[model samples]
Target: MRLITQSLLVLALGVGLARADGETAGEFDYYVLSLSWSPNWCIREGDARDADQCDARHDFGWILHGLWPQYDRGWPSFCPTRHRNPSRSDTRAMADIMGSSGLAWHQWQKHGRCSGLSSDAYFALSREAYATVTHPDAFRRLKQPIRLPASVVEEAFLAANPNLSAGQITITCKDGGIQEARICLTRSLEFRDCGADVQRDCNLNRATMDVIR
Candidate 1:
């Protein structure tokens, strides 16, 4: 699923045809690369897929969520044909960074398949998109819960990645805790402004970023 976008949960089931050739229904404007907070996901969905990542001893911060193709307002999904499944080695290589094998598979089936790239190429692009952003260290491993204005979190990220701006990212919060950081980028993998709908939902008031440990 392309989390933080219109097709957020479409990848949960990974519906569609799997074709040998890589063909998409259409092209997209840009991409929204989502980096979900591992600790937060473990806390909420520990019993779900990828329990190993939820272990208290694991020190994961923001793991690759999904690199979603996007339009200015909406996105395309369930395209005509799908790309083949990722190779065993590719899946293994991305497992640690992606959090789960199921996620990697589903992301390709649902979102990545529509990107007009082979499963291998689409995932490779996802990795590049993941590396395009520079996350703040404070959120990576907070020993204790920190309470700060959501703007501080956004500003921290902005400072870390000079190319990003206030409108280019969103600091998503759920149950009053920091959820994930959603960033907008061009098809060229360059930093860019997000559409209004993709902008951060952070508040000016104090918010909480619960430590992953």
Candidate 2:
């Protein structure tokens, strides 16, 4: 009876750890800062709906998608089922980078609500995370298509940012061009290794990154 009880206790502890790393609402282990390559996004998603971002007037490179809270294998979303409306000041502050008021609100509603932070604090953290990453010069403007191994692209980012490593990020592609760089961060917004399940998504031997002019 004593041995059986001990085994049951160990199993219970393991289960608890697993739950902490699953889709537990309003609770998370870290964050995934998704930096979208704007040129590829425009090409794939079209420029009509988000004309302000995809238009010729704004030559955006890497833009913030969202600071998404993540668990080990999964993440939480639509948490609490209710969210406060973003203030004008916060909305305007995030607009230039996040692309639009609607996108900003949607991000907060889905990802931010699960962050266990208020609207003001969550947006502030998102800005800080965006400022933390340094983009390589090659990525600043892709006047022509640049084809390189996806790992090489990840290395470029690692070289530019001192605190990051190969395991901390994954390069994602779409429509024959690099679409985004999904990087892992601590809850406090420091660079960290992603969970094992966050594998590299681009299968091409060499990937292209199209530049926006």
Candidate 3:
């Protein structure tokens, strides 16, 4: 019995250490494109989605588009712009990272219709490269307003979208900086087009997605 208990304790300790790296849910300010392992994305079914889902080995040939920062335009060889059209396809392409399991994801829609290439957000773990790590403790209790940087991200949003009649950007932060952020979805979400800087006003929504009346 003593030996068995000792072995069990050792096993439990090993498991804990393995997951300790996962405890820290990295800061999620906005969103990231590619995460790790540099996944390969390709087009499928015209409205098809995901890169690795179609090709993996020589899949780099199909990369149409990806999230920002993670997969910036610095590398033209990786982006597949010919097939990427946020106005049409609801899904987009992306590269995956290792140890990124259990990451929360979302799809953006403007004015009740889908808009923008599907971007991803994750909890960074250790380094900025691995910042995609998510916080395990912030679940259910995670309820905070979306905030944008005053001079940088905020000002840009106000200038890009004309729908924001309020012309004001608010930042909701805890440590004097943003940790979580979001704007109201578009009208297609069934929400009214109230005259204020809503969530949709910041990001493209159904109304914004459609250029034609």
Candidate 4:
């Protein structure tokens, strides 16, 4: 009886972990649109990997990282979905905004699957969400790298996009460089306040913002 009870307890724990790791598709409350600073990404990881995004030819600045479905609390990923996966061509078309077809495919498998939309629909919505916000031109016009507070990045975004508020967007830092700007939006693609879990703002006083390649 003791051994049987221990086995049941272990099974229950395993089930709990699975639930925490993933959730049902189309059940999220909102979306988080992440825009990555390409130069900073190259400086931190892409340069080492010789990623094509780091190449000077692309001249990418803020690129769409992913459009993630979010819950009010935590988040879901890798959720099982009935929709078909995107073909190579479908993902390749997103490369102009996403930086890479590989990243587009990965996003479809992870966050896109959880969106409850088909691959094409998910990509469309992601594009629409990205276009809804105006990227600050100042960042793109920078001739040299500068160190500035992460909040200033957020302020620039807010200034460029008056609809977005401080609570609706967050700036993140990685490896001491300005990383990504995440904005929360409703499922209908309207700006909305981010959930507490998604409001982690980087407090760096002088985070490096790399210039466009």
Better of 2 and 4 by TM-score: 4
Cα RMSD (Å) per model?
9.3, 8.0, 19.2, 2.4
Cα lDDT of model 2 by residue, 1-213, tens digit: 999999999999999876565244568889999988877777677565555778777777888999999988778886763447677777767977877666788898789888878888889899999999998777775568788777777888989998898889998887667878899999888889899877666766677777775
Q: All models: lDDT?
A: 0.77, 0.81, 0.26, 0.95
Instruction: Give candidate 4 misplaced runs (Cα > 4 Å).
Output: 1-21
Compared with the true structure, model 1 gives a TM-score of 0.81
- Clashing residue pairs in all predictions, respectively, total 1, 1, 27, 0
* Worst window of 10 by summed lDDT in candidate 1: 13-22
Tens-digit lDDT string for candidate 1 (134-163): 878877667887777777877888899987
Which of the two, 1 or 3, has more TM-score? 1
How much lDDT does candidate 2 score?
Answer: 0.81
Q: Give the Å shift of residue 176 in candidate 1.
A: 1.7
Model 3 lDDT per residue over 1-213, tens place? 999999999999999876553111211122222221112112212116442334434322111121222111111112211122232222322223321121222212211011122222211211232322222222213243333333333343334444432322232222243322222222122111222322222231111110000
Q: lDDT for model 3, please.
A: 0.26
Once superposed on the true structure, which residue ranges of model 2 sit more than 4 Å away at CA?
1-25, 48-50, 81-83
Q: What is the lDDT of candidate 4?
A: 0.95
Better of 1 and 4 by TM-score: 4
